[model samples]
Target: MFKTIKNDLPASIVVFFVALPLCLGIALASGAPLFSGLIAGIIGGIVVGGLSGSKIGVSGPAAGLAAIVLTAIGTLGGYENFLVAVVLGGIIQILFGILKAGVIGYYFPSSVIKGMLTGIGIIIILKQIPHFFGYDADPEGDFAFFQVDGENTFSDLYKTLKFITPGSALIGFIGLGILILWEKVLSKKGKIFQLVQGPLVAVVVGIVFYAVTQSNEALSISQSHLVSVPVPEDTASFLGQFSFPNFSAITNPDIWIVAFTIALVASLETLLCVEATDRLDPHKNVTPTNRELLAQGTGNILSGLIGGLPITQVIVRSSANIQSGGVSKMSAIIHGFFLLISVILIPRLLNMIPLSVLAAILLVVGYKLAKPGLFKKMYDLGWKQWIPFNVTVLGIVFIDLLWGIGLGLAVGIVVILLKSYQNSHFLHIEDKSNGKHRISMTLAEEVTFFNKGAILKELDSLPRDTFLEINLLKTRYLDNDIIEILEDFLYKSKERNIDIKLVSKRGIVENPSSFIKFFNERPKSEMSLS
Candidate 1:
């Protein structure tokens, strides 16, 4: 790790800049003390990053969990009580790791995961727009469609246009320009530019912009539009900011319920992020998902002990780490130390950075995540993949993160069921010389309840004066629901003037009576022809 300090140090600095505002923003969104976000950031970086098997994944207070945290805190009666839940949640997550439930992450469809990344990217860009223009009514990191402030995402953007601050907008444009230059021009020119990332330059320029415009009333950015870290007047006041969990709340049934909710949600988010970060890793390094859960659980436990929000493997910060050239876990660990040291020594300096400038940096990050090319790429993959991918993106944009993913997963499942239905059987129709239709239906190897609909549809559509052959020679398992459909169809066959022939490994049966009785009398392992 020390050998890569040259690379890791610079990458860590970039992640620190990226993480600083987010820590405060997520806390603000969660309705927790602003300092709690920073605390989570510190523990996530130092403790979780140190223990996690992921070389590039970064853990922190997730924006995705902000709504849950906000509601959990309120439901639990107080922030201290909520801390009890966080700790318990951590224990549950640790149990999840022990049970090897990390395999659940692998079950999420690739299309859904890609949709998540794209959706989050789009949300980041959309949510940051108001901040970029100096509208400070909504908190920085609140990405939900319906905000805690009672305004919807797009409505807030429209409202922000009416109250734009000149100073904030000016600095934002300047910061964005500097970032664009650093990445597109300067970074390629020399090692110095590469060593100093665009975000760091943008932050420094924002601070200088803030200081220079302090006296100009119209051009002045208000404190509300600036980074707001809890500045401690004294050591005692700083220490007072950290709150401990109320162990007495542990016995409360409500606390356990909240704990379980957080543990389940946080574990899932972490596992998804682990998969995403590994996919984004340039080297394609796979993180051990179970070990990641354990690391996150431990981080959440420490974070809760010190008045912090729940921690998860955050895709935004992890993606920022990867994009900024983070090569190892050292970058994540160093960033944590940066969070620790900066809050202690240079918080006031951090407070000088304009939120708009940070917004500009995030704009670039968002663009990278939701690039236009991804749309075309998904489209090129065909409707089967594109439908779920597009739905997930739209769901995240219009709804919340988890809901959008759930919606996409639902759609993906529907697509799978449809495919299964279509593939369940093959129908061949032969026109015989006797002016009758001879149809042969072959079942797939494994036919489930989902195949029942398609099979019934074909059977019902058969015309009169037809000879139908039901072939089950290749079928290994036929669902009982399908058997009932065939048994019922046998009675209709006579009324429709349709001749029935059933073929299976057991032999052929022509116009057999009591189809159900015949099948029920045969061994389940044996094929029944009736």
Candidate 2:
């Protein structure tokens, strides 16, 4: 950790700069006190980062959760009540880890993961356009159907045309240009360039521009466009930022509804992020899903306890962290420490940053995720890859994240099933030998309910005059669904002249018309999971 600190410190600084606006913007977007987002960021960085097994994953309050948070607040009649659910949601996540539910991340199809990254990329680009042009009527980082200020994200962008802040626009362009130059040119300038960060430079440039124009008309950014890290005058004012939950709201049915919403949505986002980030990882580091859940759960609980928004392992932040050369978990840990220290010590300094600079940062992040190369690469992999990948991208872009993933996964599964169904019929038998042909069925290892249709159809379709052999040599865990399919086939076989033989790890079960009865009759250890 110390060896990388020289490099990690600078990278963490960049992440800190990137995290600042998002914290405020997400808070504003979610209808919570702006400080709440910062709190969550701090907790996500310090608390969750410290505990997470992943070296590169970054946890924080997400734009995706804005809608749920907003609704939960109103539905539960107050923001404090919603915090209860967030805390509970965190606890639930910890339990999920305890139950080893982390493997759920592996279940997502690659196409869907690609689609999610692409869809998010598109969203960030669309969102940043207005911010890049000095339009921030709606809060930065809010990516929901509805905005905190009542206008939708696009509509707000459209509204930007009516109120262009020249100062904001100028700083945005210059900062973005600096960022581009830093990445394209200065980034190659030996160890120093690599050590010095782009986002940090962009943010500093943005601040200097703001300061120089503080007394001039050329400042395109106004007070509203600047980072609005809430300032506390005294100790009491600072302490007042932390709000406790109304435990009485815990009994409300709305509380449970909100809790469930937070739990499910946060969990889904975390799982999807885990999948997407794994793809983004150049090292191909596999994050432990259950550990991530546990880490997120712990973070959310800590965040909620401190009046922060709910937290998740966000893909956008994690991708940014990885792209910024975060090598170990120390970067995450340091970044979290950055969040904690910045908010407490120099929050007023943070308030000087313009939204445009942060927008520029995200614009770059969006591009990396949805780059043309990614599309071409997927296409080159062939239709099996392209179909699901494109489907996921389109689904996420035109519809939504969950829908796109669901649609892509569904399509991918169909492709797999189609492939399975086609491969399942090894031989097409039209003629019988010596009035009876010997036929054999070979089942794959651990055939689930998914393989039931293909396997059973192949077996049942065998002619009654045929000498049949049902093979389960490599088969493991033949679910009840498959058992029923075979049972039905066996019952129907009684009406034919078929001489059937069963071969399985359980030794054999000849003509199992009542397979369930016989299954129970056998030793429990012999029947259950190999």
Candidate 3:
């Protein structure tokens, strides 16, 4: 970790810039006091990052959870009561980690994971467009289709035209230009260029632009368009920002429900982001999902106890870190320290950053994730991959992250079922044997209930006086449903004069007695035939 400090330090700075506005914006979106978001960010960076098995994943307050936090706060009676849920949620996550529930992340199809990354990319670009042009109507971290501000994603883009700020737009354009130059040109020029990242320079220039043009009314960036870290007067006041959970609420059934909700949502989001970040990592490090859950759970527990919102492994910040060339977990850990120090030492100076500048940085990150090239790439993979990929992207863009994933997964499962139905059995007909029509059907390696229809169709279509040979020699799994179908067809075969021969690893049987009884006596649901 120490060997990568040079890369980690600069990457950490970039991640800090990317995470700052998001932390505050998410808190605001959740209707929680703004400081709570910072607390979560700080803990996520320091505690979660430190504990996580991932080399590049960064954890923090996520926009995905903003709606849940907002609704839970109100429904649970107050912010304090909600903290109890957060705490319980953390405990549940820990339980999930212990139970190895993180394998759930692996069940997601590759197309869906790619779709999630692309969808999030599109969302970041769309959401930041308004902020980039200095229209700060929607908070930074609200990634949902419908926002807490009562405007949908596209409507917010439309509204940006009506309320654009000249000063913010000017600095934003300059910031974007600097970032492009730094990435495309300057960073290639020298080691110094690589050491000092473009985002930091862009942020510094944005601050200067904001500072120098204060007297120019038309060009002055307003405070409303700046980073909004809480400015406490002294140590006591700074400590006062922390809020403890109402432990008494632990007894409330409503609190438990909220707790389970937070745990489920936070764990899922973390797992998904873990998958995404691992994909984005240049080093191709695979994060241990169970360990990630454990880290996130611990972070939430600490964050909730200290008056913070729920936390998760956030993709935006993690992607920003990766894009900025972060090579190790140190970057994530250091970014947390930066959040802690800056909020305490130079919050006023930190507040000088224009929102538009951060928007420019995110615009680049968004474009990288949702590049147009990925679409054709997915398309070339064929419909099996493309359909689910497109479904996930559209679902995310139109609905939200989880909805998109769910829809894409549903589509993926359907595709699997269809393929299964089509490939359940291989039927071959031979020349009449002993003056009787002969048919051979070989069951697939794994035949589930989804294949029942195809099998039934073939069995029903067999001609009278047919000699049917059913082959299960290579089959490893045969669903009980399919077995039942076979048993039911026994009577029909007799009436149709279809003499049946069953062949399996257990050897040949002429018209087996009771398929149900045969399988029920086996050691497992799936046949372990050798």
Q: Which has the greatest lDDT? A: 3
CA RMSD per model (angstroms): 3.4, 3.5, 1.8
**Per-residue accuracy of model 1 over 1-530 as CA lDDT, tens digit each:** 78877788888988888899999999999999999999999999999999999998899998889998999888989999999999999999999999999999998888999999999999999999899999988887788999989999999989988989999999999999998899999999999998888889889989998999899998999899999999899899999999999998788999999999999999988998888888889999989999999999999999999999999999899999988889999999999999999989988999999999999988998899999999999999999999999999999999989889999999999999999989999999966748778999999998889998899999999999999988888987777888888889999999998998888787888977766875677776764332
Ranking of all predicted structures according to lDDT, beginning with the best and ending with the worst: 3, 1, 2
How would the candidate models be sorted by TM-score, starting from the highest? 3, 1, 2
The CA-based lDDT of model 3 is what? 0.93
Candidate 2 runs further than 4 Å off: 145-164, 214-219, 430-442, 455-487, 490-530
Candidate 2, poorest ten consecutive residues by summed lDDT: 422-431
Off by over 4 Å in 1: 1-4, 431-436, 463-530
How many residue pairs clash in each candidate at the backbone level? 0, 8, 0
Off by over 4 Å in 3: 433-435, 510-526
Name the lDDT of candidate 1: 0.91
What TM-score do all the candidates reach, one by one?
0.89, 0.87, 0.96
The TM-score measured for candidate 2 stands at 0.87
Tens digits of per-residue lDDT, candidate 2, 286-331, equal: 8888888888898988888879999988777887888788877778
Score residue 501 of candidate 2 by CA lDDT.
77
Q: Which is the better candidate, 2 or 3, if ranked by lDDT? A: 3
